[model samples]
Target: MLINLWYVAEWSKTVKDKPVKAKVLGQNLVLFRDLEGNVKCTADVCLHRGGSLSNGWVNKKRDCVVCPYHGWEYNGEGKCTKIPSEGDDFKVPPRFKVDAYPVEERYGMIWVFMGDLDEKDRYPIPPLPEYDDPNFRGLETEFTWQAEASRVVENGIDIAHASFVHPVFGYPDTAEDNYIESIEKHEEWAVSHNVMYPPQLKGGFLGWRKLIRKDKQPTVVHPGWYLNGMTVKIQIDLRKDWKIVMFDANTPVDEHTTRTFAWQFRSFMKSPLFDKGSLKRLSTILHEDAQIVEASQPYYLPETLANEVSVKSDKFMSTFRMARRRCIEELGWQIDLDKRDSYNGKKVLTIPSPGRKEALAEGRGWVFETMPLVAPVKTPTEKKDFEKQVDELTVDQLNSKDNVIG
Candidate 1:
């Protein structure tokens, strides 16, 4: 998993008076709302006796998480304010603190930055304007996949698979007719417009929905991906006025498990009465997708394309891979899972949050070692060559008219 990006920790409503436990990028974290109703997140491991802060309760009087083991109180900034054994007159040392992450609430989800990058250098969270717009009716749902988060993201944006996997969206016979219309690329995100022929909407009351589109009607869809939150957004234009948009934030609970927090918004279905069918169809689509994604080979995304073959239809997905590759190779954010697994239960390592980074800069020692990262590609020549390869992947190679893709 890569660091220095925002990941959804939990639903905003879930974190109330009590502390909640969250796992992201394989590190355990504790989240709780303060007296002001602002959510705060910190490393779950307590500095005192290695206790779990999440297992404790929120001390409302002090606006802190009270460690159940020793009653050590940690505030929003993670400084240990009180130790019951030490008594009220004793002052806790400044160094007695835990790693605290930056947290924010948007679109009803709690997002935490799982790295040490300052606010200026961090990628902004993807905006979902539809979530707040009154013109759209929104429904929220969540799913967990026993697969890599990257795989889940790629599957969400893989338009070609809709034909074979989701009969409600496309037909296997019409898969060949699907084509990408245009693509827009950015350093941290990419968007693509595509055209597909799918069956008409089914199961509306009295078959009224069949009039929305004909069987095998051509539809336009725009799929986009953002590095922050590992988010995938797909907007389908059913017609000029009617549209369906899905925004999914896929979180890597670990290297092997991904939890998807999804929201579906529709322009035509404005009534709450239609929610049952809409949700049922959404559930069905997710189940269909899980069947294929979980069984894919290699388990995780490949470091390079050498072991895999990409067709023209995979060009959009390739952009995501290459963007993630840059973060791993040049930015050096990808975690060294192999090295981490070697430590196993012998050691406790946490992701370096901004607080930890600042403390270390000031010569304050920490109790746990930061998680190891994959070594970045060293040397200016190698960096240039890697950039050239990325350009080729995006321009010359992927843009080729041939059916084969590099």
Candidate 2:
């Protein structure tokens, strides 16, 4: 994961008056809303005895989070305000604080700055203009993948795979048919447009019936720029009056882990009842993509185009990979080549660390590099239990941020 970027920590409703745990870019953070209802995020570790603050509670009156172990209270600013062990008259040193991260509440998600707070504004979160349109309605879903963030984002944007991996979105008959009209790549972002003849379900209920029984559709796919960045969008026409957009906010939990929050926005179906069915179908389609992505090779992404084969239909995907490579090679972001064994293709376990940021003087530019250690995964024996895998999308991820498994 890169620094100076915004990553979804948790959905807004998930972080209410209670401290909630989330991990982004390998940082364990606790989120809670203050008295004013503004969200605040900080390192989950207690400054004193290394206790977890997520195991704590919110002090409603003081608008602070109280540590469960010793009742140490820290406010939104991350300043230690009260130490129950100390007498009321004892002055809590101003220097006693936890690492506070910048946070924003947008699109029903709580986003946190996973880098230097000063750099947050430079890389703004992707805007959703459709959200402001009264006629548009949507729902959000979250999923965790045992794959790298780059691979997960690539899966969402890949046009060719729709035919093979996602049967619901692409017909098996048109699996060999491919089309890509145009692609544009910028310094910070990139856009690719493709002409697609998608395969739809032949006969089904409301929306599905309309799509399949109608004329064989040739649609356009307008994908957002900067494929490897925090946001990815796929705008495709579902019908003349109704268009569907799948906007994904991809976050790296660690080197080989990802958190994806997708917003399925449709301009035509404004009814909430209809949207519920759409979300279920969309969630299932995305899960199909996940199964294939988790099985990809060279987990950290191949170093160059030479590392993998490509064709004409892969133009947009290739561009995204090129831009991502530039950031890793030219810019400071790097991949941990040593973490994976060359002979056996096995990943070694190591304690994960956050990315480091390097900046030029006078705000010229900056680069964030991976710290190189793989995030720790608990062996199943350690916990003596494995949580049941929930295939359906839920308010929270199928796997809560707290549980770790081998």
Candidate 3:
């Protein structure tokens, strides 16, 4: 996993008032929502002791998270507010805080910058405009594959794979003829505008023969790949009234593990039934790809072109490989390929997340120790400042002529 890019940590719905564990770019972190409704991402280990913060809970006012081991409190900004070990009056040093990655919640998934903060904005999570379309219903999906993040990302933008991996919309014969009409390459991403001809659509589960205008409409697809964790595949049908857009955000759990967060949007899927059906179909299709990907040789993507074979149809994948090579060579964002792993008896390369270094640095950081289990004390504050604000909003809502509450 390369640094300086946003990776999906987890789904927003999974994170509640209690802290939850999420691994991205090989670093274990915790996520939770404060009373203000803002999501907070912090190093899982407590700064004082090595207690995992995910095993902790929120404070009385829901202002900060309290550690289970020593009751060290950290706010949404990742600053230690209260250290129970020291008296409440003892002010915690500024440096006595866990590392907090820049995070934002977008399209139902929490994204975090696992690299330098300066580059966070340079590579914001790829946008999914289809999710906001008023005419389209949402089809959300997620899957975990035992594959490297790089391989997971590359396969997402590889059009050739759909022919063989996903037989519903494509065939093996056309997989070799997947010619790239054009490719736009940038420093951080690559866009492939290609053509896909789904041979005579026979009646099946999708029933594309009747849904489409013609027996086989040449679909033009533009797949954009951001080397980090986001990809978008947009298919435009000229004769049809609707379009299909698939968005994916792939996060790395470890060197050989990847968790994918995805969504399928259709201009015609306005009903909830279609939304559910599309999501179900998408799950099956992705698992098919996973089966092929897990058995893939040389788990890690090869940096050198000579290490693997390539063809003209591999234009997009090739560009990603070149850009990935630059990240490994010039950007100093690489992994140690010599670390022995218990899986498969072969060493898998693993990159050191900068987030982990900052978490373990001076001033102490999140705890990594497995201390004795302890329960958190919940002392909900009696109608306080936040409740007062809520009361004011409630009054304003009641006084308003419109029935809608603000």
Highest TM-score: which candidate? 1
| C-alpha lDDT of residue 106 in model 2 | 82
Q: Write the per-residue lDDT of candidate 3 for residues 296-372, one digit (tens) a residue.
A: 87887765543455545665665566566555555555543333233322322122234435655644454332111
Residue 77's lDDT within candidate 1 is 87
Error of 1 at 348 (Å): 1.4
Off by over 4 Å in 3: 119-121, 202-209, 213-216, 230-238, 337-406
> How large is the C-alpha RMSD of every model relative to the true structure?
3.1, 12.3, 16.5
Model 3 C-alpha lDDT versus the unseen true structure: 0.67
- Which residue pairs in model 2 clash with each other? 171-199, 190-225, 190-226
Cα shift from native, residue 226, model 3 (Å):
1.1
Off by over 4 Å in 2: 117-121, 171-177, 206-208, 211-215, 225-229, 333-406
Q: After TM-score superposition, what is the CA distance of residue 134 in candidate 2 from its true location, in Å?
A: 1.3
Range of the 10 consecutive residues with the lowest summed lDDT in candidate 3 = 368-377
Error (Å) of candidate 3 at residue 186 is: 1.5
Number of the top lDDT candidate = 1
Q: Number of clashes in every candidate structure?
A: 0, 3, 7
Better of 1 and 2 by lDDT: 1
- Which pairs of residues collide in candidate 3? 4-115, 45-366, 45-367, 46-366, 46-367, 47-365, 50-367
lDDT of 2 by residue, 224-313 (tens): 644333578888875576678878888888766788887888886476867667777888887898889888887766645444455555
